[model samples]
Structures are given as structure tokens and as C-alpha cells.
Target: MTEGPPSILSLAWLLSLVYVFVAAVFVVRRLTDKSGKELARRIKAATRGRDAATDAAGDLVKRHEMSGLRWLDVFLSRQAWSRRMDKMLAQADIEAPLGIFVLLSLVLATTGYVAASLYAQNPFVRLAVGIGLGLLPFKWIAMRKARRMQEFERQLPEALELVGRALRAGHTFTSGMGMVVSEFAEPIRGEFQTTMEEINFGMGVAVALDNLMDRVDCPDLNFFVVSVKIQNETGGNLAEIVGNIAWLIRERLKLKGRIRVLSAEGRMAAWVLCLLPFFVCGAVQVLNPGYLNLLFTAPLGHILIYLVMGLMTMGILVIRKMVRIEV
Candidate 1:
């Protein structure tokens, strides 16, 4: 059964709801950024005769760390899931609460399920649609985190060079790390700041660096951490070591880029092959609804849809395998 376009009223209601949701988001962001604390801080500052600049300087240390426990942990019975979500959100630079993100996912999933249910008469299909839609927020965050990590990887060699230069200039290791924090941009800056904070709070250098590796999960960073740890124990020229590591990573990235360029044609062809069937089928359905309806009316048509989906999945996997080049 073909569904017609949504009614104007329904569209208008959706738009209004979206607007409300967006406004709520802004309100939440403002609260999260310590807006309420600002007044209290200002009054205290006035009493103590602290400067506005001092209050503003607090911005560097101020961040939205989830206070107390979340209800999600009660149902899940594990702090692990909450911690994982927090890590992913940090990696993606998302400045929202975990609960808020979960709520947003639920809303999107409900919307998608309703839309899918109109077209799909099957109960299983509706459930599947809801589940898939529910994962969209997580998928979006994961994609964002992946992109951020890639960007971090790109910035790393230069960041390493800066750190190495700082060390060569006779700075302490912590001071050199601080120089990276000041000189480079986030997420490198934020990451280093977090590490420095941990150190200032009495965490050992090795442990703090390990936490850094866990959060960033970059191979080049792994080298940095390991080299630093080994050097602290074994004693060596750390600046030259870091510089060499940075040079190696640059060469590796260059080779990876060359591989990507070489495989570009194959990747394009794969995309076309995967998408052409869907495009042709959609055009045919629009032009000749009756002709396309015959397939839907027949039991064999359902089987064909499943078969096509399976084939497409296999083809996509094969193409991915072909194009993937590890550096």
C-alpha cells in the first residue's frame, strides 16, 4: 500500500514540536554551562572582592561532568554503560547530558517507527524499524567521534613536533605538555589539559598518560605514551624520540593517502553498483505504480525484496574489504 504525503496539520505540528525541542535544547545548554552558578559566584566574588577576570578564568576548569548517579544506571545495573556513553560523548565533543541524548534518541525512534509503520504492515518490520531508528543517535555520535579522532590523528604529528621542540628548549615534561595545550587546538588541548589536571591532582605520569591513550585511542599517541613511560624509567633523549615517531606517522599517513587515491575509482564504482538498483526501482514505481504493485501483491515479491537486501549487504561487505587499506 502506497502512503500519500503527510497532511499540512501534521507537518505543522511536527515543525512546532521540533522548534520546542530545539528551544529546550538551548535552555539545557545554558543551564549546563553553569549559568545558575554564575549568580552565586558573582555574589561571592563581590563579597571577597575578586575580579571579573578571575571568575572568567574559571572557564578553563569548568566542564559538564555528570553529578551524582543517573537513573539509567539503576535499570542497567552497571556504571560501565554510563561511563562508556560519557567517553563517547566527550570524544564527539557533545556538550549535552547523557539522559538528554537518550531522550532525543527515543523521540527520533518513535517518529521513525510511526513513519515506517504506515508503509510496513508487518509487526516485525515495525519493531526492526524502531530498533534501527533508536540507534541513530548512537550511530551519529560514533561517526562524529570517529571523525574527531581522525582529525586528532592528523593534528598529532605536528602536536608531537611542538612538544618535542618545547622539550628541546629545556622545558620540563609537564611544562612541554602545557605548551601543547596552549599552542595546539582542541581536542588535543582539552585532552592535554585533562591529563595535566590529573597530574596536578596527584595522578602519576604513567597512569595519566595511560588514561590519555584510553580516551584518545590513537596509535601515534600510544607510541608517545609508551615512549614517555619507558624514558621516565630507562632514561633517554625524549625529544628526538618523539620527533622520530612523528616523522614515522607522517610517512604512514602519506602511504595511506596514496592507497585511498588509488582505490577511489573502485570505491565510486561500488557505490554506483549498490545504489543504482534502488534508484531505478524508485523511478519505475513512480512512473508505473500498477506495474510495481504487482510485485507487492505477489508473495514472490516479498521474497525478492529480502533476496535483494541480502545481496546488497554481501556486495557492500565485499567492496569494503576490497577498498580497506591498513597503514
Candidate 2:
């Protein structure tokens, strides 16, 4: 017998092709990657040392600038959805092209739709599952962004203190930022590094700071930036101001920690209540698949399942709202 066009084998092939394409793109990118800034730094060194070999290497880098998946960028640049995804990716410090991410999402959604349509035999369920699966990449990006922001928050006070110390040691503001870039761990270090580069690239202090604030999306960073700008304008002691901001951040962080601890029980209860039904249903299904098959076969069973799912969703949202205490 001949196989149909939309057989399992064909779907698997399609999924494999997508994965192969993604892997090839990323692997090639990694293999060919060069550091644009590093090359510039080397060119400066070569000029200072008057070395012909170093100049040649730096010139080669300039000639062959590092390339990314710019085709996707060109194609998706006009779309609003792609723009929003780009912003999210920027905040998350993701270096992948938005087009590539969207392509992966499309492939996953297509696979999910095909597979679920075959197994679930319900159009609504297939659509829902497909969309949810498609959004998994974005969900991952959001989680990464949240984690980076949390780490930034944890490190911001210490970074500020270091910057203040650098200023007190009679360094310029840019030099102080360089100190943070050198002393701090990741996320914030990268932020300061970018800002320093921006300033070096002819951007003003206010503009570079605004860019930093835009990239990080942290209010505490906003406070620090604004304080620095104000101190710069008014000719006050910037070192003292930044130190005070650091101390203030410490106190606010302490209060926020207390609030989080106090709300831990509510969060735990919310999670338990939200996931209990699914866990019980899974247990029952494991015990007897035939028991849940009735829900797929009977009209009344569909109604009950729909009602229960709706109520569970509402309960989850309510609990989310109740437990989310913003500082």
C-alpha cells in the first residue's frame, strides 16, 4: 500500500529539515564569527606600535565584517510583530535573528497542529495546542529576560558603589563606567560596556544612558541614570550622590525581599490549586486510559471538561493577581 501525503514519515521529515536548517545556520554563523570591536581595538594597537602585520590583520577584519542572519532582518523589518520580538530579544540579550526565531516557531506550530490533529481529532484542541506550542520560544525568551533582570537587580547596588568609588578616586564618569564594566558580573557589566562604547562612538552621556535604560528595562537603573545626569548638570558631588543611591537601593531591595517571603505561601497555594486537577487527571489516565477516552467520545464529557478547564483558568488568573505584590 502507498502512504498518504500527510503521513507520519512526511511530518517527521519536515521537522527534521527545519531542525537541520536551523542548526546549519547557527553553526555556520558561529564558525565564521569575528569580533568587530576587538578588531578595532587591535587596529588602534597596531597604529600605536607601528606594526605592519597587526595592521594587515585589522584591515582584513574591516574588510570582512561579521555578518548575522540579515536576510531575515531585511524581510521582517517592516512588520510590527517582528519589531516587538526584536525589542524583547534585545532586552533578553539574545543574539539570534528574529526571523530565525519566528521560523522555528512556525515549524513547531505546524508540527504540533499536524500531530494533534491526527491524535486529538478536535479542531479547537489542535488550534489551541498549535498556538501554545508556537509561543514556547517567546516564552523562553521572556523567562531569560526576567532572569537577567533579576540578576541585574541583585548586582545593581554593588555596581553603583563601585562607580562611586571610581569617581571619588578622581576618574571621569566614563572611566567610572569602565570600572563597573570591569568589576561587575555579566548583564550589568555588558550594559556598562555598551554605554561606554556608545560614548566612545560619539554619543552623549544622556543619550547613552537612555539607551542603557531602554536595553535593561529596570527602574533601579533608571534611578541611577537620572541621578548621574542630574549631578553632572548641577555640579554637585556625583560620588556622594551615587553612593547614596546605592544605599537606597539596598534598603528597597530589603523591603522587597520581605514582601516576597511573606507572599511565598500564597504563591505556593496558587500553584498547587492550579496544577492539582491536571495532576489528578493524568494519574487517572495512567490508571485507565479507557476512563478518559469517554471524555473524547461523549458530549456530556466534553461539556464537563470545558467547564472545568474554564474555571481552572479563572482560578489561576485570580490567584496570580492576588499574590503578585509589586514593589
Query: What TM-score does prediction 1 earn?
Result: 0.80
The superposed Cα distance between candidate 1 and the true structure at residue 161, in angstroms, equals 1.3
- List runs of model 1 lying over 4 Å from the truth: 1-6, 11-70, 76-80
Q: What lDDT score goes with residue 140 in model 2?
A: 95
* TM per prediction: 0.80, 0.80
* Global CA lDDT computed for model 1: 0.80
lDDT of each residue in 1-327, candidate 1, tens digit only: 967877879867875786688568657655555546766765667676556646654752353344312344244335677678878887888876676667667777776677677677777688888889888888998999999899889988998888889889999888888988988987888999999999997789999999999888678788889999999999999999989988988988899899999999989989899989989989998998777886766889888888988999999999999999887
TM-score of 2: 0.80
Looking at model 1, residue 139 earns an lDDT score of 91
